[model samples]
Target: MNELNGYDIEDLEVGMTASFSKTITEADIILFAGASGDNNAIHINEDFARTTPFGGRIAHGFLTASTISAAIANRLPGPGTIYIAQEMRFVGPVRPGDTVTARVTVKQLTRERSRAVLLTICSVGDKVVVEGEATVRTTSRARREATV
Candidate 1:
């Protein structure tokens, strides 16, 4: 697994942590809107968004949540991980130019030892913007060794 730059299931432990960060940009909002087909006014239309409860343009909630995905893929479990389930709660709005950091902590492994359950959180500075849990399966050392 190290050769492939990913964590095998045997490499994970409860409380292990990792993170990824990106600054949300105007282009990111527009691109996400186009790529995801979420053409909502709050994301692309500032004037229209101004009247909404957010008071101005805000990035899509899933866009913020995607940062969490990034942490799981690129940090903790690295490349060979598959999502089994994810539950996210969008707690705060993210505006353009905000530097969002997504962090994942190993909460516990499933009883079967085949999956990892992680506490996922995305935040801007000290304010938590999104929080969740993610269940993912990573390559097993046994499987990798057998394949080799």
Candidate 2:
């Protein structure tokens, strides 16, 4: 959505937050499984997954986390931001048809390095599915330059 404009490194402030929501789908799981080479049956085979504690096939954990990345790249810091590192903890499972919301809040910023540390989270309704921290190297004035 063009509603969000990328913020320069200097413009970011602690407590600034952004979010995006997506509905998990079977195709999403299948595509992510192929792209990530994670052929784990728990994510692809419902019959096999039904035997597990999760009760049915679950989406790849990284797929859920990628929603958080999408929020960062498209919403908060917006474009021209490069992911430096991320630490994630998968606390719950996401199933097809579930609506997941990804949120990122700026926790710290280093102006000299143009880096920001953010608290990232993904949830299905009130239950947290994933939580973590991400560090990004952001560009100052890159959005303006790209438009020109």
Candidate 3:
């Protein structure tokens, strides 16, 4: 890890991997709804959600997908990473009490290691709930040293 508690551009390798996990909770859903203004009934109302194909209340796709953010921001390229873009597909529902494990793998790196493409995946046990890709920029030790 670099002084920033993250990977410096030069520290990254194309196959590096890391993960983070969190269990969805009622409070998490409510808080997400309040914070994001995404109060869709399927995510916040059990009865309304039951009528949908999901069968019961489900966490917001973005809320559940937040695990992927956590994985990227706290692991792998870590703290100094700046996301450039992301693409995601929500394939399954995550309910309250489901533990979501998000994994990130380094897919590609620029020659200078200043940019990276990562594969992101989140699962509840064996069921994949989210799959995606992300591009990010990282701090460069050479650049930082040059400024000093």
Candidate 3 stretches with Cα past 4 Å from truth are: 3-5
lDDT of 3 by residue, 32-72 (tens): 99999999999988889999998999999999888888988
Candidate 1 has a TM-score of 0.95
The candidate maximizing TM-score is 3
| Clashes per model (N, Cα, C within 3 A) | 0, 0, 0
Q: Pick the winner on TM-score between candidates 1 and 3.
A: 3
TM-score of 2: 0.91
**TM-score pick, better of 2 and 3:** 3
lDDT per model vs. reference? 0.90, 0.90, 0.91
Residue pairs of candidate 1 with colliding backbone atoms: none
Task: For candidate 2, write residues 48-108 as lDDT tens digits.
Answer: 9999999999999999989998999998888878999999999999999899999999999
Report the Cα lDDT for residue 147, model 1.
Answer: 92
Candidate order by decreasing lDDT: 3, 2, 1
How does candidate 3 fare on TM-score? 0.96
